[model samples]
Target: MIVSNVSLSGCAGANSALCAAVGDGHQGGGSYRSTLSPTGNLVVAVCLGFIGTFGLLNNLLVLILFCRYKMLRSPINLLLINISISDLLVCVLGTPFSFAASTQGRWLIGEGGCMWYGFANSLFGIVSLISLAVLSYERYSTMVVPTEADASNYRRISQGILLSWLYSLAWTLPPLFGWSKYGPEGPGTTCSVDWTAKTANSISYIICLFLFCLITPFLVIVFCYGKLLCAIRQRKYRKFLAALQYVFGLTE
Candidate 1:
């Protein structure tokens, strides 16, 4: 159903599911509105509820485990805790409104709420992705160097975590400043970076976000893990060769 205040003229003749022109009271320009049926909205609400609940509990468990166990507080594992924190924030700050909107079959909050949801989710999600990349690199470093110094390198770990958050924040803020925008996304239940806007600024922001925030982190994770696998295989191979040589020498 269209927002009560939103005019039918703007979204007229457009597919309800795909329409993004529904104007809200707060946003004189327009915002997205879901035209989904009641059953569909119920399904969406149920799914969001499940995901939000499960994610919140799971991440909270991770944080609790890390905090309770001193051995789990290693410089490397701190990255995992960072990821958990970001996930937990997403569940807390982002999921509830979406869940509420889904239950109501439209965005319950106004434009300001939409923008806040979009920015908050994007920031936290990007933080989680960057943290994963950093964690992979940390693992690769441990495997490759295996140094006592690196194992206890709390300073390095802190720097990595700080960089992950700062880098994610840097990218997510541009939308707020009008580099692109943050608005309602699919089904109008959630909000995110505006992907449909074709303006130069919006297009540029999307391209940069895709490359730097997403692609860069993905490539880092792949490269680090690839090198790690190679190192492990080589170590195993050497161990096998040593075992074979010992067996032959004993036989001789």
Candidate 2:
């Protein structure tokens, strides 16, 4: 009887442990299922598809305009090319990840994916802004001093493009190298540099906007307009004086 009771007790204890293990597994499975549902997955897939499609179309249009038209092949158009390329990257690389995040409300791509997305997005943003600045400067130069504008060389344009790419890479590479880092908010959601984490990301974006969009472009436009006004005034004065000379000669 004693031996039989001991065996029964042991069996009961084993059963209890098994039950507890099963219970814990059930809870874990439930939590995971709730976190990643089929609906969420579908949403993510759709978002990525749409973003990719849009990017493809936009980039193709830009490429067509630049390639097919000789009239559009100028310094200003070169800057547009850079902008279109950057926008293409943003649509192809950055937006798909963003769509995943938006649909799933989490990051599905993991740490490596997050870093890649952040880097591409940041790089393209910088390129777009720099291209805008270059375009503005080119327009201003063209208007302000048309003669001097003819002096822009291939070397200068190439240097500007290189510098813009380098500037973009500088902002993007740090996060990849761990000097900074970005991660998904969750399973299907990714984010850029943690702007809310008291990092310099927000500040850098603000400074870039101020410098390229507000300060530099504004100054260029103003200077260009001033030069235009002076030119117009001089032209009018010369024409008026010529007319007066003709009138006096006819009268005499």
Candidate 3:
């Protein structure tokens, strides 16, 4: 009789389960397991705090250098300032929440917060890439065709900066418009773009990677470096020959 009673109780417990069994006191399914330990959490928090602080300081320094020193304000420096601002935004907005999400073991920020986080992160990342491409082109032009370089004035540079912002906006707006989905991870509950989802929008991210991050930038960098290298080699050949002459004379 005791054996039968035990079997019945076991069946009931397995079938009904407890509230703990159902959701683990969190919104998502699966057990709530923290990816970070106490020490890890503290370390991450401190690191992110440092990043945020440094980003603020770096942006302020750039601003001060540009404003106080007239010579520091150039088209290239302006591009650098914009990149610094993007980094500042990332450090200020993304890193702290990432630290918290690591500790809390779940996303307490909700759906709206998830969208905002993803948008800001994506926007900044795209902007940084575009700025790198622009800088590379500018350098290439400056080195290869000095005459053409003179045309890269503040007006043209400003237009380039505006175009980068618009490109970032194009990538980031999809989530807001319902074309793409942004939310916290299930099981782990960390906020990020849902790249692995079986959706058309998810595929758009892969396309974005190829177009913006890989192919476009690869072509830009390769083209710029190729031209720059040829120019440098041409200009330095005589100097290199003179150095070789001195070395051979000393050997003799």
Candidate 4:
């Protein structure tokens, strides 16, 4: 839960804070970099720093456990490890710069760094999503189809993790190649693919990214988890019925 809160809050709040800062600056006009006095910016930096530190420590501990224990080396654990990698990257690569930018009241990384940061942020976010969906599917398979055949699928799951990273990378690069462009996102606190742009290419990229990267994995995780819960209940109910029959001497 700590891991989830820290990772998700950092990811969501980082972006949302930019939008919030923008709104604060322009009073609904949505201008950039005019919001937040120096003190406000410092407060934001302090908050982000705390969030990033907590998340980084938790994820690092998990990684340390994974590396330290041979028993922790399994397909499901690998999926979790991959997820941790993404969150850890978010903590290390994304967080401090956000703190610096927030406190400094503008992007200090220049244009190219801004683009890289945007791409990296998008990449890490997508990787985390894909990792979660894959983990959900693994859990579903384990619960409903715990067979030798399913056990053999471990290699494929690991391969899927690798593929997901590549998939995330592929989508993040389109902006660099001009499908859309990375620009100051909301109050200039961070850089990302300019979602508010009115260009056709920008709209197309946004739609595709939403559908493929975000929506697909989200639906997969939700569906798989729901199915998993139902399966467990069904299994337990069957066991309950069997116990009742055995006690009542009603053999079939």
Best by lDDT: 1
Scored by lDDT, model 3 comes in at 0.66
- Cα lDDT tens digits, model 2, 1-252, are 001123332434433322222232344321111134668667766867786788779887988988999877776677778888888888877777666555654444544565667677777887777666666666656665564323454456667778779876865666565454553333324446644334466466546545754576467656666666777798899999889989889534
Q: How many residue pairs clash in each candidate?
A: 0, 8, 0, 1
Better of 1 and 4 by lDDT: 1
Candidate 4, residues 1-252, lDDT tens digits: the string is 001123332435445544443343334232235256888788889998998999899999999999999888777888888888999999999888878888878666655666778889999999998889888988898888675534667787778799879999999989988898776675577778888767798999999999999899999999999999999899899999999999999978
Q: Residue by residue across 1-252, what tens digits does model 3's lDDT show?
A: 001123333444332222222233234433323445667656666776687788778887887788899888877778888888788788788877766765665445654666677788888878887887887887887776565323457777788788788987887777676665665443333445665456676787757755876589779978898889988898799788878989889434
**TM-score of candidate 3 relative to the true fold:** 0.75
Computed on alpha carbons, the lDDT of every model, listed in order, comes to: 0.83, 0.60, 0.66, 0.79
- Candidate 3, number of clashes: 0
**For model 1, what is the alpha-carbon lDDT of residue 68?**
94
lDDT of 2: 0.60
Q: Per-residue lDDT for 79-142 in model 1, tens only?
A: 8888989999999999999999888776767778888999999999999999999999989999
Q: How close is every model to the real structure, measured as TM-score? A: 0.89, 0.61, 0.75, 0.83
Model 2, position 150: C-alpha lDDT score: 39
What shift in Å separates residue 205 of candidate 1 from its native position after superposition? 0.7
Best by TM-score: 1
- Candidate 2's C-alpha runs over 4 A off are 1-52, 147-152, 185-188, 199-252
